[model samples]
Target: MFREIPTVNRLLQKKWNDKDQQIHLQKLKNAKSTFNIKKRRSSSRRISKSTSKKDKIQEDRFKQIERDNKILLQKMRRIMKNHSGVNLPFEKGSLNKGMRKKQLADITLANYQLLQRLQDKKSNYNVLKWEKDRIDNKKLAQRIGIFSSTMVDPAHSKSKQALPTLKNPRESTTRMTKKRMKKNYQTELQPLEFPSSFPKRAKTTTRKRKRTIATPEEDGDKAKDLDLAKVCSIPEEREVIFQASKNDGKKYEVEISQTEDKMFIAAANKVKHSEHYLIELEKEKGEEILKEFNNNFQVILDNLKVISRRLVLLNPNINDPKRANTTRNRTRKKNFRKLNKRGNASQPSLRPGTVNSPSGDLMGVMPETARPVSPTQNTNDLQA
Candidate 1:
């Protein structure tokens, strides 16, 4: 039975080994099939990815080429426009460094020439204008009698030569007097003939008096007193009355009284007639003075106006010949003259042959008569 058991165990072991071997083989076949399928799928995916990448690269290259072509076209058009009339090696293209520098130099030279021509024309015009102005000024000066024919030449003018030698009248007189006095003094000092028997006069000497100083006792007695007066007793209240006169021949009273506190107070029953009269007098005096001042001021103003009118008529801005000839200035001056004439004509005239005084009165005329006449008329009609 033990030998049979060994055979049976061998047979079981063999069968189990066969079953295990079959299972392992089946697993290997399944694994090989799955691996082959996976490898085929991977290869197809790689092929598709490579083809797509190539197509994208080609598209990008074509787009970049199109952009570059557009940019080049724009540059070509700009170069053609800029170099239109310029003779260059490239007729319709951009210039190189040397060509660009040559073109800039040519343009600078043309600009410089144009500026020089303009300056020359301006200088010529200025010269002509200056000559004309010089002639006009000479004529104006001659007409005004400011420059005579001979006086036009400064070197020939005697006044110009003598101006440096001229001295103030008072200074010259003083210098001449001093010189004569010096001569007289020198002549007087000459030795005078005298008799030998004449007694010699003694020279008297003068002594200066000295100032005296005050002693302490005298200074003490001379000290100033600054003490206030003392009151002995308080007095009873008393009223003092004052009367004043007015221009109307009326009298008013002012009362002054002493208070218990030693203060003196003044009270008026009514406004003082004298104060009103004084105030009225002051007002009248002030008005008279103001009237005199106004008359004098008006006389001066009229004289100034007349003088300014004469001056304007004489020269009319002779210093500036250019401004004097403008149409606007001429019209303005005409209007001013018309206004002045109308004002002068409208003003009342003074009595014939009456001289105007600075105090706004006519000489040899009563104040009443002068008061009726305008002060401006007398001054304006007086000719130098």
Candidate 2:
């Protein structure tokens, strides 16, 4: 009923309160916009805060730089005022003797160290270079002795006698035979048969150690149950251990140690004495022998050749013919006839449990194998 008048007024009026309608429309737009508030206010506040923080930092840095420059200037002024012209921290005016001396020492030391460092690294740094070009791949290889050796190829050999030819045995047969003969002679070397030989070599006899019953208690209770031995490296340690030795009180016992050995080595320090006994010819002969032993390898080789030749001449009977057995009677071979009975059937035989059967022409017999289990005797023996 209240809206009927307003409806009639809206119909009657062509432009019914346009300004008021615009105001209402503007109010509605304002109300819709109010739902979306400006989020940039807090962001703008943060941005302002960051800018202020940056400004503060810049100001602090500038203040620090100014302070440092002021301190440096003050120090420079102090240095100029001082007699020593040193830039060390000083008292208001003059320093005490101790401080002055310390400052001078530090200054001198610094100057000396600076000079030394400059002397070592005197290369001109002003001249720029990409690289100094000191690349050497074989530097380490050059230092190693084996790498430095002139010989590199494994196939290259120096001696006329090349490696033994395994494919062709005849190629190295002469050398092989010679080496075998020399080895045989060396292994079977015996002293010359001398009628007046007084036998100077001592004949020592090895005494057997008495056997003791090794009980489990004795073995387990002993401190040396472990196979590993306690080793002492220091002299003091060994000395401390000497008192606990089992042979400490024994007069007949001899103690031997692994280290700190003062047992006078007769050959230490001094030039090795003449190996020649000097009982033979003269000093000249001795010197010649010494020189031959030390240097003249060819001469030694020649001497050895002569010795081998002499040995060949002396041992002309290298292959002794196999002598026939004149002493040993050659018995005629006994013919063993096969029998037709079990050789192991001894239960019904003359001797019970004996692995034997009646020896007869028809009895079965186990044939004896020709292969001899025992080593054959050398027919060339003096006994044979």
Clashes of each: 0, 6
Estimated TM-score per prediction?
A: 0.15, 0.14
Q: Name the lDDT value of residue 225 in candidate 2.
A: 27
What TM-score would candidate 2 get against the native?
Answer: 0.14
What's the lDDT of the predicted structure labeled candidate 2? Answer: 0.35
**Model 2: runs farther than 4 Å from truth?**
1-43, 85-384
Candidate 1 off by > 4 Å = 1-100, 103-126, 146-384
Residue pairs with clashing backbones, model 2: 339-363, 339-364, 340-362, 340-363, 340-364, 341-364
| Candidate that scores best on lDDT | 1
